[model samples]
Target: MKDLFCLIMAGGSGTRFWPWSRTVKPKQFFKIFNDESLIQSTISRFSTFISTENIYIVSNKSQSAVLEGQTSMLYRENLIYEPVGKNTLPCIGLAAMFAELENPEGIMVVSPSDHHIHNEKLFSETIHAAIIIALENEGIVTIGITPNSPATGYGYIQTAEDITGRNSIKQFKIKQFVENPTKSQQPVTLKREDFIGTAVYLFLKYRYFLNQ
Candidate 1:
């Protein structure tokens, strides 16, 4: 088995969920739906597949202390504190660098800490399959979540003809990257807008090599 490394992006302030999600405590730290916070839930879901030591939480410096107290399984060093938030690209780049340093052949899974997965088993199985595809193909692989609805709040990935299989890492030509709709309209209704980019990605071994 390849050495698996998980990077949980927990840097967002979650302005949409504001009032409750202040700068001091972002949405990831809030247990809005269940017993555990979003970050905790994300990490717990991956624990079944990867060891605690191999998991990493990349976030801004402000939330480091709070995050440290919340989860005992995560160590201080494992929590990477970035000076400032430069969005997903930079975050992924830093993670790739760390993954390369830790293990050149490591399979790194990068995902947001705030999102929830209804089907835990299926999600895990899919992620594992993606890692395999990434290692074999030696290219950047992103997992496009099976769209439950036409969600306007999230970006859509128009899959290319080459894509196949339920858990396969298929090539998806980056189509229109749409923003959250202004209001709940017709087909763009809140519920119908289900196909949102989960920001979940699997960086292949060679991709990791190049980034580092």
Candidate 2:
């Protein structure tokens, strides 16, 4: 796992969870289940495989105090802070730059800091599968959750006809993304091929090998 790096995005304001999760202390810092906070659990999940040195958390500079108090196990430098919350793409781009500086060929696995995944063993397997796919295909690989309902809140992923299967983990060629469709637009029962966008991504330093 020397070439594997994990980037956890923890900069969300948690405005959706207003009453409990404030700007001062977002939902990521809250201990939603058990003793560990959401962010802590997230870190722990990746720590099972990725070294502590390779796991980095990106959040707003304002949350430094809370982040420090919560995740003291991390290296001081690993806690990357943005001057302001520029949202997901910029946050990820910043971490990608950091990973590239450390190792140009490193495979960066990006995840959210607030997700609650129950099955740790399966989660690790899925991540490793995605990493293998990314390295073998030299492209971006994402984990898509099969949506059980026609939920309009989350974006939907449409996959192409082609499928790549390895070690029981199947990879699909993404056709397009349907962002938060209305009830009229979404089918009452989703097709087996469709999936909800979970934002979990694995890619090799923004395709660094392309330059070679």
Candidate 3:
């Protein structure tokens, strides 16, 4: 994992999970399942595979203390804060930029810092599978979870019907990115429309490496 870096994006105000999840204490720092926070669990899950030095926390200045307190294992230097929220793409771009500086042709595992996984074994295997795909190709490899029910809070990914891959991971060609649907649009049927769902794991292989 020399050129592979795990970039954890944790910079939301938790507006969606309001009241309980306030500005000072966002959902990322909340211990919903157990003693550890969501961000902590997210970092810990990848600790076994990715090195601490290569793991980065892209958060906001407001939640710096919370991030630091919750993630004791991560180094202070690895935390990158933003003055204002410019959304996910920019944050990912920032991490990619840093990764490029160190290693021009590198693979960055960009994921959310707030989410839960039922099976660690499967999750780890999926990530490694995505890593393998990323290292061997130029395209993006995303781990899209099939939603159990209608969810308006999370983003979704829609892939082509002709999914093909040797591994358990079925590689699908992403179609289009759709916006969050309202309550009226419940049970919205998706046909590679990239509907919003429970969660999505994005594995990006920077443009620098695409030429190869």
* Number of colliding residue pairs in each model: 7, 0, 1
lDDT of 2 by residue, 75-164 (tens): 989999998788767787788787777777788888989988877778778888888877777656778887766777666777776576
Put down candidate 1 lDDT per residue, 1-212, tens digits, no spaces: 44888888888876868988876678999887899999999889888878888888888878877788787887777888788899877887777777677777787778888887777777777787777677777567777665545555665544444655565444454444444544443254334333335455655663545645
Tell me the deviation in Å of residue 18 in model 1. Answer: 0.9
Q: How well does candidate 2 match the true structure in TM-score terms?
A: 0.89
Could you tell me the C-alpha RMSD of candidate 1 in Å? Answer: 3.8
Poorest lDDT segment (10 consecutive residues) of candidate 2 = 203-212
**Candidate 2 vs candidate 3: which has greater lDDT?**
2
Query: By descending lDDT, how would the candidates be arranged?
Result: 2, 3, 1
Per-residue accuracy of model 3 over 90-156 as CA lDDT, tens digit each: 7878777777777787788888888888988888888888888878777777777766676666656
Models 1 onward score TM values of 0.80, 0.89, 0.88
lDDT of 2: 0.79
- RMSD (CA, angstroms), candidate 3: 2.8
Q: Which one is best on TM-score?
A: 2
